[model samples]
Target: MQDIAVGGSTVSRTDILGQVEAVGVGSFWATDEEGRLVYLSAKALDALGGGGESLIGRPLVEIFSEVQQANGEEAQRTLGFQLRSHSRFDNMIVRVDVAGDDETGQRQTRWWRVSGKPYKDGNDRFCGYRGSSIDITAEYGRQLEAAQHSQFDPLTGLANRRRMGSRLSAMLTACKGAGRSCALVMLDLDRFKQVNDTLGHPAGDELLKQVADRLKTVIKDRGEIGRLGGDEFQIILPDIDDRGDLTGLAGRIIQMISQPYSINGKRAIVGTSVGVAIAPYDGVESDELNAAADLALYAAKGSGRGLCRFYTADLRESAELDSRIEENLRDALVKGEMRMNYQPLVSPHDHTVHAFEALMRWEPEDGRPVSPAKFIPIAEQTDLIVQLGGWALRQACEDAVQWPTQLRVAVNVSAKQFMNADFPKVVAAALAGSGLEPNRLDLEITESVFVGDVEAVDKTFAALKRLGVRLVMDDFGTGYSSLGYLNRAPFDKIKIDQSFVHGCTEGGTTNPAIISAIVALAKALGMETVAEGVEAMDELALVTERGADLIQGYIYSRPLTHDAIMERSGTENFVFPPSGPPRYRAGRMNFFRKIGVIHEDHYYKAMLRNLSRTGAWIEGLAGVPEGTDLILDLGGGQLAVSKVVRAAEAAQGLKFETALIGDGNDGLMTRHRVSPYALATAGMPLAALPAGSYPLAEQMSASRSPRKFFEVEV
Candidate 1:
């Protein structure tokens, strides 16, 4: 009953038309002038998935809708617009209303490619629209899969570097316009290379996947996390510029990633270092922000692994300085610029010197002193650490040989140096060349030595044990705390890290409990435990009570030069009295920094002489009476509310209303900085804060309060 045209031939074939409808590839659909479906073939009804009877008079637009492009760009025209214009539309992709599911119980989207044209009656009057929609589910799914592959890492299911860069760019653009802030976090795994080199590549892949999953649990919906290849990762946090919050998040991330992972029935532990940068504060652009974060990460890892550092302005200078030092480090030993400073470790039971830890000191020919923290990592990166490590071992043996025969010398070993195949030969050469007793030579090793093949690491330990030098574990409980390390490797002593000793006497800290647990574990293992970094009497008393076998830190002495050590080598001089502060006080940094002080409406310049978490000593303003309230501007839009607690002729000690936060570069800062939004409201252009202070607008008002204090012209 219908005329069909095919292959330049026309014939009346009702069976051929029925076969077309039965094939289910697609079917005819027709709607009234008002756009309600009036006619639908069997296949068209099946495509809607159900309720064929109810769909007879429903609007076709209700069944399918337009979607944004996969890359999140807006479409040029919507399906509704095409329908309303009564224009011809062909091969337009649309989403179906029915919720379909994939095999993994995840919801899968359904798509269709539709073609339509407006039809007219015999009188050439507009009647309705006739459309055909083919099943494009499989083809559209492949397109979506390709997009996902481009944006996500195949190994970890996290966003790739390209995707993260795009995301950061888009977020910065949006936040810059809205006067909001975003923070970027850069982190990478420590000791991850060992996992890869020890285990197979497949195990490394599994570990990375596990790390990504843990990051997701911590991040939740707070931000986007991406893998920047290898063991490196990045996260984007929105609407936050508070340093205090960033510190907490960074700490959480480090702690989370430092936990142990199980890969192929083998227990692996790794540490993480985090660097944080805030947009419109650290930088307003993505590349600038990334550079800032990278510098912070460098500082974090260099200081110690498993730490978090916030990007500060001074890190760039420090990085440049490190670069120069790295270049000079190649010849520092040959130039006689490096030496060992000894700090004694005394036995608590006898109160006598038992051993001395050799600390490396670097002084360049130009009289510039380089901190070990800054140069050590650089040496490691340039493979100069191997040479330095060998030199230090030999120098310690030579230095200790000149002291009492019974005294022991401890030399710190880098993971790289300890893992070298000829490490035992180096130890033997140092001992044989210096004529020092093997038992008197202690080799201090960190937990990070468990990086490569377990069997190979065991062989190295065995080889070192055969050298007759005692093995002492350094910085215990700081990172990689698997009991398997202690169980397998024979350790003679354990050195408790200084971090636990810092605030062990403080009421709220859990450091005392951790120290006690460490001592107990060591005691049970028949290992001698030395509490490190005891700088005050209270800390010494606490560690003494915890049953530590030995104590080493400033309570006895700072690092002594080789001549100083020899000056006290006699038996009578072995006893060192505990001399330090009577009680523990939180560390305070003393420096001269010009800052702005505002009392009432008057702004005066002051010098911050010393800073701590709880208070600061300021000089410049006279007659600042005790109990007087004021605002201290520490530059870069930072304001601290304080009260004058003690007053002198031209100096005052101020107690902060809120405790200050660490700038992550061993400096103090306000918890929150003044925002760009506030600056824009005060008539400045909307942008990141520039250097120096931003005075309060209310204090800059026309009606100023009378000045009650004198500004000392120091």
Candidate 2:
């Protein structure tokens, strides 16, 4: 009921074939009630290919040649039956031959589905037929595939168990009715597990497939064959008519399975046992026949594994021990007895301890300690690793925050733990609850974590970054992580796996080359590199000489307690040494009660106008670079100092290194940035002023570019 404008006027029809053609559906007309072609949609013309428009007014029979006309009449009669019965065939199969080219220069027949229904005119009079003919060649291909698989096996493409069963059932039924004979043979390969164990499962599978092919050649049109399962096969011989036929088929199968197979350059001479059961003689039922065949199989196995035997009643004792070990592992995780240990990572220089890496350890009271290589894989398969990883993170962070400021702790993360949806939030909450600084925490993840759901990894990393925790790519150069991911990932450091480190100390020069390459790559990417498993001084020296930033192994003390960390950091003098700086001592004589230092005749108030170690800025005359090294010469004496550290928008003052004791009762302090003085010049509150107004032009320019970009009115 939609309106459309024509060239001059609008026309309406109860059934608009022309409108349907305009919308690209194939539409056509037929003359009178005889179904003669009149007009057609462009889609119909295109679908018919070249010169199809020439037969617009031709009779429907003219569209087909002589042979097709006969087929067309039969199709019409079938369609008439369906219509009269009011039965709809949703996807009834039909085929048509269209002209096509093959490899050679000749035409070939192509198939498509043809549909038709009676077309009616305005007065409710039947005019002709109209329906869409769709291409269903792909459907026909799938149908063929279904039929093929229904009969043939997926692995060897020989007859499968279902097909073989059907064939055997039919043959047995026929033989029982006709007073003939038939036999069923079963096969089981011997030492097949040994082949799989020694040569790999793929080779064993190839052997089984070859066995099927060989059996087919030997039996040749005399029986049906199938693969029942791994190393198990079945054969059905029908129209046998005697016991000799059953014996012959069994011998042929035994001979086929006894042959040698060459797989992956390895020669394997494997053997199989065959069992036979005759229908109408052994048992009448299919299950009984199969039972007898199984008994025969067991007898064949008992007779030395590579020969055939007839079924007997006493061979039902050995049915396999249900060796599924997966159930015992399921309940092992819930009892809560997993444990972990920490390994100390020592600084190669001065043996100052840096961090402790948390390593998982598990030992069940009833059983021996489970190897990390064993239980870790199982834990990862379940959710045990996720819970274990969270426990590890929390414990590490708690212990880390209690350690001296110089040492930062690291925890290894498994691939499963890294992919956990709550990993980032868990890490953040752990850090916050532990009262630990984010920079003191490091998460070490293996390269395998990057292989899965990269988008999820990316989001996880983004969440971790919000917590300010450092990420280390654990065991670099051992996994499939491309150099590209290393470049893009938010990794703070890369730890060379212990295996590679172990090789680096070996006298051979190859390890050095590989380690050097890794170091160079890390350097190029602005990442710190650490070498693990440096157990000797020579190894330490080699790694340190090659510019390895960190070394962790047994060369130093193992993971220590908080008291041990304090002891390692040295005595109270080393932990809390005194700091010296300019002291403004009046002695009832010094003016203005503030110390001053002169830099290029601009006197900087040493105490009030100086930088605080707590990162506050005060007004001072001298302006220095963000990281400039300078000496402050107070009226008392000179003290070595560095300039303020630069920050985003706001600049921070330097960390004091050497504030020396000057003349009598006076201490020399460092100079400060002139930013506060610039702030006083503007009416704006001192803290509110932009950093750019300072005489420290470089710091001002870089730190406050956004503030300088636009004009501001006084």
Candidate 3:
């Protein structure tokens, strides 16, 4: 433009440009044909945070890069690429990200918008470029920050639900095209509501933050985790199809998140149930995979809280059963379908009954017997546990009052019922109504009851103790409760968890040590210790030697009805000897079902007589030698490599080469399963390989090889 005339002088165009450089509004620059900086304004030198002489010969493109767009797509042309092409460009946003590039040290990244064109020299050859740049750091930074806020959860700084969904969709699409697999894990906190209800919403927020942190640590760089509102979360684990790895990841997640949290100076404990689904096997799309993972999580919760389960086709049936179970459970009390069976807690020293634990049994109207493992979690999720627990306490007390005066009865108290303000009153009412002494009632509680306000929990415990009822911490030494809690609560007894009791007698196990420590801890505190689930003489002997004060399990007797107790009480036949297996067997389920046994290329039909994590019994196969390596196809894509340990006639005992993991329903399953990719590679159609059927992956099904053993019908 034209120069401006002042009062006594005229301002030249060069002088106006110098004023522009002095104000830091914009900067002028020129590059040689080699794209090296030949001239730069003083403002540009300040922006580079370097001396003018030092930056003169440096490549201009080295000092700047194109700003990345909001979307994750790569830029078609970078500034360096464009500059090398000798092409004109306009209004391109660029960023300087070099360390120590800021003059004031207040900014690490400087944004610029510039326009430039190729210029020719005296010889008519391309020699340089001249450009001007305006600082856009303020506006561009705000845009980037806003974009970040939209994609992440403010509290945990994890991806939000929308971003996680988009990521899963994209990953699944990419994996499907590449013939890879992705795993989706769904989970939510258990009993988190009790924390919020007792401690307040702020503490709940703190707990969620801690949980998110633990998830980050456990999953670390392997996947993306997102909070889908409330206590629910979803994880996208890319390129993982092996159930073995997924099992480990899900386990670590549950273990990490289930640890105790100190929120607002109050201790809180919550558990998580994880459900895993793999793409192309469980589903090929995002929605399908999510639904599958959700169903698996439902099954995990149905089995019980604090477990992990993989998606299976049968979970759909289980979902329906859960619905039916919940419906029937609502009317179970009114229909008189619920009953109590007392399992005697006997003194191991005298083999005499010290007390009976009142266990609730419900026989539904449909005549199907649903285990507590499947239904109690459902009840806890709703308000049914409180009602059922109230009824159970009254019924158990009423039944106990008829027994001999010296014997007391223990009744299980749910965390839901225990946390209620009126629970102590409920216990008093049950005792007064049944005419049973207050001391005759033992209130069974678990560590989960200590999840909320510390003062409130202490007050409840004090109130129960004031009523003269004994407090027995059920499932003690199960990693849920610490010794510090024992000092806080007044417990008359501690029942060692069945988990420690089951394998105590086996060598190389820490259960014996844990049992000893528990018994010692209880004795030191003047509290009685009962070894629960002592189903074998060895287990009984081990516990008795470890100073356990009582034993309560099948080793003495199964849970008996009131009539059976009355019949036996007349004769005073309380002194019973331990009657169980002579040794501790690795607790196998008597799973009698048809399965397939593959040895080499020959597939033999066999009957699975029993199944355990370590081994299984198979029949319907003859002439199979011991130490023979075989693969047992236990359906559901489970192929267990095993060796015949015991061979007799048509019966054989097979030891698993690799032990199976929990199916999350108290059953054993192979950790790694045959994937669809492997099936497709073997030229087999994508079909379900289930129990009771043998489809030899199509390629091996047409083998003309001779059979190794005769397959007889069992």
Candidate 2 or 1, higher TM-score: 1
RMSD per candidate (Å) reads 5.0, 34.6, 4.7
In model 3, the runs with Cα more than 4 Å from the true position are 1-43, 46-62, 65-68, 71-94, 98-107, 113-134, 241-245, 479-481, 602-604, 680-701
Who is ahead in TM-score, 1 or 3?
Answer: 3
- By TM-score, how accurate is candidate 2? 0.38
- Scored by lDDT, model 2 comes in at 0.59
CA lDDT scores, all candidates in order: 0.83, 0.59, 0.83
Please give the RMSD of candidate 3 to the true structure.
4.7
Worst 10 residues of 1 by lDDT: 683-692
Over 1-714, each residue of candidate 2 has an lDDT whose tens digit, in order, gives 465568987766524755766664444434445556665556556655545566577665445321222111123335435444433333334443334333453433323444555656688777765555444456566766776767767889887777777767767788767656667888877657657765778887888888888988988898778887788888887755243345555666665665556777765655667787766556656788888888777656544344566543334543221112123344544665555566666556655556678777666657776656545544554566687788878877876776678668899897668877788888989988999999999899876565323455788999899889999998777544337568669898988876566646555447677778888889988899888876656666777888788777766544444455556456522221112222211112222233333232233343333433222232333334466432333321123344556522222244446432211112222222222333344232322333334443333322221221111111
Q: Residues 1-714, candidate 1: write the lDDT tens digits.
A: 578788999866756654777876576778999899898777756655454546678787886677656653446656788889888899888876543333554433468788899999899888889888777779877777887788889999999998899989989999879878999999998878878877878988999999999999899999999999999999999998888988988877877876768788887777788998888888989999999999999988877666788888888998897888888888898899998999989876677998899999999998778889778878876579899999999999999999988789999999889878899999999999999989999999987777545667788889988989899999998766646688988899999999899879999999989999989988899999999999999999999999899999999888889998887875348888888997889889997878888766566789999989989899999988899998887876777889999999999999999999887666788888776447435543212234445545334443345778898976
Which digits, one per residue and each the tens of the lDDT, describe model 3 over residues 32-56?
Answer: 8788988877777776675345667
Model 2: per-residue Cα lDDT at residue 6: 87
Clashes of 2: 2
